[model samples]
Target: MVTASSLGLTERQAVILTVGFYMITALIMVSCNKWALNTIELPWLLLWCQMMIAVILLKVTHSTGMLKMPEIRIDVSKALAPLIAINVLGLGVNTLCLVYVDTSFYQIARGLVLPFTVIFAYALLGQPSSSLVLASCFTVFCGFYTGISTEVNVSQRGVFFGIFSSITTSLHAIVIKKSLPAVNNSSLDLVYYNNVLSMLVTTPIVFLSGETSKVMATLETEGFQAFHSFLAAAFVTGIFGFLVNLAGFMQISKTSPTTHMISGAVRGVLQTLLGYFAFGDIITTGRLSGIVLILSGGAIYTYAKDKEMQTTTKPTYIPMTQQDVDGNEDNERKA
Candidate 1:
């Protein structure tokens, strides 16, 4: 029989396991959100509830010493404000797109994220890229266009929100990369601060958007049983949402952002297949071609970037002193 110690996994195995967990939880959260949106028609409320639950859980963890709480200074909060704002808007619009579009189409629509990310990285951060990378992004965009054009049950509103979601999502990622180190927080700490800030920012918007009134009306007209069911779904989805964030952060911490991007591409394919089998979504030739194009382009971009990084990364050179050389010689002679 294999003992626990004998069965211990290596660092690479651990990273793989974490990436798998992140992808699964992320896919589940998206599916669950889509389901809840279809059933309840309250996307903003669901999002707010998720943020609230995340904040509560994070607090509990911190109080119990299960997690460390980051130092929350006004300066750090201000620094993260823009990122938090973009994150909230991205998620809100993403949820709205799910409400409007079929799950299958939604996956295809999200293929624009990589291209948009590249564009924003260049514009905002002055990051330069190779022609190959740009061409790959163009291929990805063509895939998105092909998928959207061929979507039989396409919603113009869904398409609109999806494009905005991609833009905001890319911006959020770029800002996180820029701001995360300055804040000097761990992944969990960032999660905590992000949800806390999101809750604060979205609360008034929920009321102003008239979603609060709708929720109240839903509770009154739908009866206690229906209301309870909605709450239960929201709560479960909230838990999944937190897991997604936690796992994503853990994966990125253990691996490179490039690895995370590749995992996301894989997850997109899995999600597309799941949408078809689970929701009876129609799969056309164009859809298949689009998926292939996007995944291939993304993989190429990731590979090219990884190669570039390898070439650009310089090994640290530590000069040896005469004393150090003498010590090494002495040790060698003794050996």
Candidate 2:
């Protein structure tokens, strides 16, 4: 499935790919929690240990000259500061908010991110948003409401935290999109920057007051079986986490910010389906209706908005020379 931009994704394909990515993530998370619950003591420090392992792998790859070098231009005085700052807060707040939210309501609340992003882009960055764009945002929220109202009496705290997450997530998208033109960094570099910044900011608080030590002790004292299960879970998570971040970020860099945001809606729907299959959560009619609304809204909005933009403004990608047959190669290089 492919889009008009000549990118290799049809609307349905996008949803399926996004769903597959997050469904696997949900399975990993659920399996990890179950393993923790059943074990004598949970391997709480497994994630940190996994991070250490990742650092080792990164060092080895770099030393062995296996890691691909990305194009890097120094721009500390320009977009780097703000982009890094926005993502740092955005990622941290989103992660912390999950502690206060339930997954069902969180999915619904994330729909709000579209509208917030649209508003921020318009008001702060002076980007024009079409009526279709606005409608898409509303439709996503409606879908979220449908999904949540069906099975659970959504909690107020979850709703609040979900809203918080949406806003931060939107801000993250807007900041990254706005800054991409000037950053001149590859996807790998962006991933490294975002992850390193997030780790630095999240670390002190997570580890202070002996939290890190306690978590590590829990993992060590746990039986070998428990520890191994945790190690496996952490390994899967770390690898997939990096892949998702890389793919999603690169996709966003090539596409419109709004389209990127809408594409991510598939994550919530997919996660819901995964919950049903893996966690014994039942999907109700209302939830299915919500999923339809989200998919429909995203598709309609992206097509309409792109059409409108093309008629009035330049296409997102322009063929500059005979060498560029398909426009996507240039877009990818630019991104």
**What is the C-alpha local distance difference test score of each model?**
0.75, 0.55
What TM-scores do the predictions have? 0.86, 0.70
Error of 2 at 217 (Å): 7.8
The top-ranked prediction according to TM-score is 1
Q: Pick the candidate with the highest lDDT.
A: 1
Give the clashing residue pairs of candidate 2, or none: 1-9, 1-10, 2-10
Displacement of residue 144 (Cα, Å) in model 2 is 3.3
Per-residue lDDT over 114-183 for candidate 2, one digit per residue giving the tens place of the 0 to 100 score: 6787778778777777788778878877886776677565556656666777887778766666555453
